[model samples]
Target: MPWLARSRPLFPAALLTASWWGKVLEGGRAAPRNGRCVMAPVRAVVRLRRRVCLQRKRRVLGPPAGPEAAVAAGAPGPGGGSPGQPRFFTFDDPAALPARTPRKRRRRSRVVLYPDGARRCRPRAERRSSRAQRCLLLLVAIVGFQVLNAIENLDDNAQRYDLDGLEKALQRAVFGQPAAVARIVALLRDYLATHVHSRPLLLALLGPSGVGKSHVGRLLAGHFGAVLEDRSLVLQYHAGHHCPEARAVQLCGDELERSVADVVARAEAEEKTPLVLLDQVELMPGALLDRVLGLLQPQRPHPFQNAIYVLLSGAGGAEVTRFVLQNVTRAAPGETQDEAHAGPRAHQTDMELRAGLRALLAGAHPLWQAAAIVPFLLLDRHSVVSCFQEEMAGEGFFPEQARAERLAAQLSYYRVAGHEFAVTGCKQVVAKVNLL
Candidate 1:
């Protein structure tokens, strides 16, 4: 009852008891207790409470009053609290109000390694799509670089070799000497072929110093559009403080050799042959001669294998002297020799100059068999007159002179020198000219 007092309102209980007492006292009006009489109010209060409890039960439990409905209707619980009230949640009891299942966490998308060892991140289509873009960029870069390289190569090829300058200079220098000029130009043409098959050639210009050996070298190099290198300078540089024979080994030690090798290598790589004009080549040693001779040999391909030519120019006088000394003995007790004194000496000079050149052709007879060895040594009359009139006359490198006066003076001297040498043809012409 004490517990009921705490649970239910006191007024409802008091009203109930009062209604019960009225029911007993109004027995005479018992029929009215059932309806419109003295117990009607009490019955009304009971019906109202029943409706209230039913409504509360419906609200607490769902529509058809469950255990929660009984609690709302004031049913007493064994634990002393309202029946069906919630307590602590226990996962250990399966029947305990179905453990409110934790909402499932959304599955996270992740990168995974496949059994085949490939990375499976994006879909196959997406992966291939991106990879193709990168590959295209790389291919573009490679193609661009190759194109740039080709353009640079073409530019380098266009660089001038100065052939025009050489041609003009030679034309001016040898105006009247057409025959000599033609031979030289032909040799230059052979020397300057920019192919590997054509070999280099030797030019042994034998004459006194004032006879224009230097001019010939310059003209040849100029004609071929080649670089003119002073052989003496190379010799001095390589010889250093050492001997000539010993100098060969030290060539590798000098930066000059490396520089030359680099130039030759670059020429070969570019498929352009380079011609080298080495003046005063006689001063160079036999070993160096052998190397150059090898290049001139027909069987071997041109050195640097491009448009390369090496023209060797020097005083052949010394070479001639050596040849004569080696071959000829003193005339037998003053008996006549083929070339007594000056004859043997001159013959020897020719032989020496020829020997060095012959040495170049020795083993390569097959290649040289068909080639002509035309010996040319003359300045034509027209070229001489042209030089005297244009270059020597105008420049005043010689005294200015009237045409007839110059002619008479020149004719007088010519007759004198011609009588001394007694040589005819161009020799007579040169002797006459020299006297002038």
Candidate 2:
């Protein structure tokens, strides 16, 4: 009778029991036996669960129309408000709520100062010191290498023979071309003095075979302390066959440029002036000749600024010889020779040489026209005799001067018309001396 007095007439006991059992199972507790009243703890849990469910349903369905409607729908008011007044909920202060166990903050590694005034992170200091040491070591190594390189360069420069001595040596080594020798020496002197950018020294050695064209180049190479036979800095191409054909070639366009650039780069890296000797250049095809000339053009920066190009051509050899012979002073019917006569004759010879060379190269490219033509004159009997003597002395073939002179005299000399001619120049002389 008491339970009936507290219970609402609209509420069903079966629904309440089922809901209570559901909440107990949801809370991970076993449901009690059937037909038994729930315990006090279970009843409190069911009351709280019912309150939460009623609040959620009110939110979704919106608030009931009035307290009577709420009570009729079996929705309890907060703190069991009277049926006449609207229910109002109150919240406890966040600070007054049960304090949560404070989560422990992870301590980050930090650089701490010790009582001894040293940093606590020794590894960081060690790392910094090690990095500084490595940088210092690298810098020192770089400086040392540069110093050694500079010293080596200085020593090399110091060891080089003076240009004057080199010129004299070249003159002695190459015979029968005094004018050519003097001009070459002057050219070299000018090149050394005024190394104007983009203007490389070009020498065209024009003469017959065995007239010391190649020998002059060798002398120049030796003067510069470079080995002419070495193909690195001194590029020697026998243009007759060794030069690549213009159309039928492996390396062309960019490949050709790269190859040439690589060679020039190597010479520059070694601080050496590249010397290019094109032997029998007249025999080279027009295309290949143009390619070589393009390297010397001034439009772009090139390693050829310090380079020396020696072009050996036998094409104009006959004209050179004829021009030299025609300029020889043969007193015109008792005209007395004097110092004035000597100057005029020398001037006339130079004029004839230039004229002849110009005529010979008129059909060729302008590049060849701009070159300094050095005529390697045919060696006279005297020069050839001297060459023979020098060779004999070198080989220890003739310790006695008398034997060398006799052998030189016995060598057959050719006669063209009335003038004496050493047809093979110093080549035959050297051979004759070697044979003896």
Which has the greatest lDDT? 2
* Predicted candidate 1 versus true structure: per-residue lDDT over 301-389, tens digit per residue: 34433433333333444443344334434333332221242343544443444556455544433222223332222222333444455
C-alpha local distance difference test of each model:
0.44, 0.64
lDDT of 2 by residue, 1-436 (tens): 3443354531455456568778897987776676446555445554655666676676566656555777776756544853543555546553454544435689999965568865555566555657788899999999999999876855554334256787788768777676677777877666654323467778888887777887887776665544323467666667546645554533443444455676667776765566667787877766666677777788646675667788888878788667545544452433321221344465566556767887778687766787888777666566666777778778876546676567657654554434444666776666676666
The list of candidate 2 runs beyond 4 A from truth reads 1-161, 194-196, 226-231, 244-260, 270-272, 330-344, 399-419
lDDT of 2 at 219: 74
Q: Output the TM-score of candidate 1.
A: 0.36
Residue pairs with backbone overlap in model 1: 176-383, 194-307, 273-306, 273-307, 274-308, 275-309, 320-348, 320-349, 324-348, 414-432
